[model samples]
Target: MAQHETSGFRSFIFSRSGMVLLGFLAVAGYFLWEEHAAHILGYLPLLLILGLCVGMHFFMHGSHGGDHGSHRDEPREDDR
Candidate 1:
């Protein structure tokens, strides 16, 4: 278990996305340390709006039209 955990950690540290995230956090930490909270806060709404728009775009079209049930809504001719 420890070995697996260590390997996963190593891979995350070496991965491009993970490295970018680490860099982002480091920069954010520096800004926060410099008391640039207001500057960062100014972009909060933009980020939130962008994130929600992206989430809605992906999820809104991801459905496969499966809401219709297996059985037909209309009665069969034999039922007449």
Candidate 2:
């Protein structure tokens, strides 16, 4: 019997449309959390936003610059 082909996480992460949609959702979530839930978070929106930005930055850009920290070393704009 032939094995079924499955992309699993790769399909979701590598899709251009998925990335664009995820980016939009991230921005929208940030705004909603900042404007609506800041008081609930003790007004730590700046910290949250900074942390999120840093995390995404590290995920998308860090490994591309010869950094051995990332698990998935996908190609970046510089390599194109």
Candidate 3:
């Protein structure tokens, strides 16, 4: 059996620019919480639900529109 290679945290999770973007988001989130906490908190549930639905759609629709190569490259004996 072949062993699976795992990537390090920075390389796998986020690139250098991604780290900066995350930091910016953290700062923005803090400002939002400080300035508009009630409004942002009220919208949080809707944003979470929207993200979940979009993620589900992408995950359910696999590679090449859910084909997953179930159909053979060549004809089989079962085909008439």
TM-score of each: 0.38, 0.37, 0.40
lDDT, model 3:
0.82
- Total residue pair clashes for candidate 3: 0
Candidate 2, residues 6-75, lDDT tens digits: the string is 6877788668988998999999999988888847777587789999999999898865676465645777
| Sort by TM-score, top down from the best | 3, 1, 2
Total clashing pairs in model 1: 0
Q: Which lDDT value does model 3 have at 56?
A: 88
Q: Which stretches of candidate 3 lie over 4 Å from their true place?
A: 1-32, 63-80
Quote the lDDT for 79 in model 3: 86
Segments in model 1 whose C-alpha atoms lie over 4 Å from true places: 1-31, 64-80
Q: Whose TM-score is higher: candidate 1's or candidate 3's?
A: 3
Count of clashing residue pairs in every prediction:
0, 0, 0
lDDT string for model 3 (1-80, tens) is 99876677656457877788889999998998799988889999999999999998888765656455767676788885
Summarize candidate 1's per-residue lDDT along 12-73 as a digit string, tens digits. Answer: 98899899999999999987867977877898999999999999988997875776565588
